[model samples]
Target: MLSKRLVSCLDVRDGKLAKSVRFVDTKDIGDPIEKARTYYEEGLDELVFYDITASSEGRDILIDVVERVASQIFIPFSVGGGIRSVEDATRLRLAGAEKVNVNTAAVQNPDLITACADAIGSQSTVLSMDVRRAEPCDAVPSGFEIVIHGGRTPMQLDAIEWAKRGEALGAGELVVNSIDADGTKEGYDVELTRRIAEAVGIPVIASGGAGRPEHLYEVLTEGRADAALVASMLHYGEYTVGELKQYLDARGVKMRMRF
Candidate 1:
């Protein structure tokens, strides 16, 4: 079995690392490049930097931060936020990101997915869906609904359906973030993650509500996720990536045992 990955996410607003609950009350955590370097040097498997407010604030991702973080960290990095077109994706890739994450723009124009895949290959394209589970809205049941604009504007799209669509459009991976669970650190929405993982064939990275190592193990082993993405836990010195890895390894959860 492939080892489960430990990915550290940095929600960047104005080039500063930040964290929030349900995408609200966001406060600066630290510097982006410095934070990214800290995680990479600490043996994180992957790093994701999100320009959290770009979509809602109506601006492009902070390229300066992306450029600096990319130059400082050796680990594979993925970036998202205000990424509108293939050109934008290309710019991020050129700026040192191994992959580009798309959210609102993809929902607005899914054809952009095809355009991106044609240019950057599917493996380098990541589709991040910010989901909030609402009971029986419109044509869907009590499942996940996609939210854009940093989880402010609700898109009338079903998260599971979008996952299928993303896979069809040649997306290589999915980041299923639970807005309800974001920053709660209670635990991952394993049930939601399980449903999405079952519905799609690509690797799914379970995000939001990861408080402890067991949460990561549960998400991978029980939720059937291929990986877990965490932010607040690592940012606040709650746990280190290596510490989580060791915990998982001890539990027999597949993990990268070597740096």
Candidate 2:
């Protein structure tokens, strides 16, 4: 079996690393470049940087900041927010991002996914979905609705359906973020993650609600996720990437351990 990956997320707002609870009450924490370097040195398998306000602000992503952060990290770097076209994705790749993630713009124009995949291989195209629990209905039969603009707008799109569509559109991977569990640090929404994992053939990264090492184990195994994206637990100095990987590796979850 392929080793499960542990990814660290750096949510930036106005060029500062920030954190939020339930997609609200955001507060700047520290410098993103410093954090990126720390995590990379501590054995993080991948890093994801998101410009939380870029989409809503109607501007391009902070490329300067992305370049600065990229210069500090050696792991696979995936960037998102305000990427509207193939040109934007190419620019991010040129800025040192191995993958370009699209959320709001992809939902607005799914063809953008195909376009980016064509420009920079599908393996470099990541489809990020910010989802929330909703009443099961014909519109969202999976009971999960995709939200955009940093979870401020509901798209009424079914999470499972969108995952399949994203794969069909040539997205090489999927990041399923549960807004309901985001920043909670309690545990991942295993059911929601498993449902989407089973629905899509591409890799599924479970984002949000990672508190302890056991949570990562559950999400990686029971949740059937290819990777687990962490924020609060690692951002606050609660756990280091190496420590988390050690705990997971000892529990039979294969990890890329750097000794």
Candidate 3:
């Protein structure tokens, strides 16, 4: 089996790294570039940087920040937020992002996903879904709705259906971020993660609510996620990538060991 990946997420606001609880009460933590390099050197499998306010503010992603961070990290990383067109994805790639994640833009114009994939290959396109639990309705039986624009707007789209559509539209991967579970550090929403994971053929990265190595193990194994996107667990110095890997490896979850 392929080793489960542990990806560190850096949510950037005004060029600074920040963390939020349930997508609110955000607090600036540190410099994103510095944090990216730190995680890379610590043996993280991948890194994801999201310009948290770019979409809501009606501006483009922080290209210069992405460039600076990408220049420092040896491992692959994805850049997201306010990427609205194929040109935006191209610019991000040119700036050194291994992948470009689209959320609001894709929801507004889903053809953007195909356009990006056509220009840069499907492997370079990532669909970042900010989802929240909602009342089950005839239109959304999954009980999970897609929230975009930094989790401030609900799109009335069903999460399961959206995941399948994203894959069919050539999205190489999906980052299923549970808004309710985000920054809680309790654990990933296994039901939400697993539902989307089973619905899509592409790799699903479980984001939000990661507190420890055991949480990572559960999400990757029981939740059937290919990777776990951790923020609070590693961001606050509770554990390093190597330490998490050791704990997971000893618990029978396959992880890459950093010597």
How do all models score by TM-score? 0.94, 0.95, 0.94
* lDDT (Cα, 0-100) at 100 in candidate 1: 91
Predicted candidate 3 versus true structure: per-residue lDDT over 110-159, tens digit per residue: 99999999998899999999999999997779999998878899888999
Ordered by TM-score, highest first, the candidates read 2, 3, 1
- Which parts of model 2 have CA positions greater than 4 angstroms off? 55-61
The deviation in Å at residue 108 for candidate 3 is 1.5
Clashing pairs in 2: none
Q: For each predicted model, how many residue pairs clash, with residues at least 3 apart or on different chains? A: 0, 0, 0
The lDDT for every candidate, in the order shown, is 0.86, 0.90, 0.88
Model 2, backbone clash pairs (residues 3+ apart or across chains), number: 0
Alpha-carbon lDDT of model 3: 0.88
Could you tell me which residue pairs clash in candidate 1? none
Q: Write the per-residue lDDT of candidate 1 for residues 16-69, one digit (tens) a residue.
A: 888888888989978878877877877888889888664433234477777787
